[model samples]
Target: MTSLFAQEIRLSKRHEDIVSQRLMLLQQMENKLGDQNKEKTPQMQRAETALQRNLSLLKDIEAAEKSLQTQNHPVPPPEVASLETLYWASVEEYIPKWEQFLLGRAPYPIGVENPNEAEATIQKEVRQ
Candidate 1:
């Protein structure tokens, strides 16, 4: 009976040592995770900041393009007169017949107000 008691005590000690070793390993893993998180957070913040800056720059470029478009002629010289001629020709062909359903005489000399206004005006008139 005494020998049996000694065996039970030794088994209990072994179990306790195993549990302590497992706890130590778990604590070490938790510490490593904490360190990794600390290292990663600053890098993530810097990336976020860079992304925001790039987005802001893109918006500025778009705004600049819009401003430039409204300020002066959007089309180059060689394309301008050709585009105008094509536009007026299409208008002469399409608009009056589509709306009134009868072949009407073409308007004489469809003149543009100015180079800047010509493309937009022609597009609007053609849709009619």
Candidate 2:
């Protein structure tokens, strides 16, 4: 890949990471507010407003990505695609522990599975 292509890929992945973080935050807020008996405080009201805004933003991002793809954006080659898929799968697995830390449900954000172990598992899955 050219340097410019590499940079574009990095930027795209970063955008995806930011979107995932926003979704996680929204999920955390929703879980906290799941209790119907709880009164809506100012903070809760703010969270609700933010949730709506985030949902709208997420929809817009998805639509923009679809438009770009339809407009002939370059697709990554198979090798890059496979590696990216594995990278994202690992990220998805780690996100829950990070979310728990952010929500104060955990003291630290380390994933339950060892990184090496996770890599091995992913490689095994790929081989199969």
Highest-TM-score candidate:
1
The C-alpha local distance difference test score for the whole of candidate 2 amounts to: 0.81
Instruction: List ranges where model 2 is wrong by over 4 Å.
Output: 1-72, 111-128
Model number with the top lDDT: 2
Model 2 worst lDDT window (10 residues)? 109-118
lDDT (Cα atoms) of all candidates against the true structure = 0.78, 0.81
**Quality of model 1 by C-alpha lDDT:** 0.78
Compared with the true structure, model 2 gives a TM-score of 0.31
**TM-scores of the models, in the order given:** 0.49, 0.31
- Give candidate 1's total backbone clashes: 0
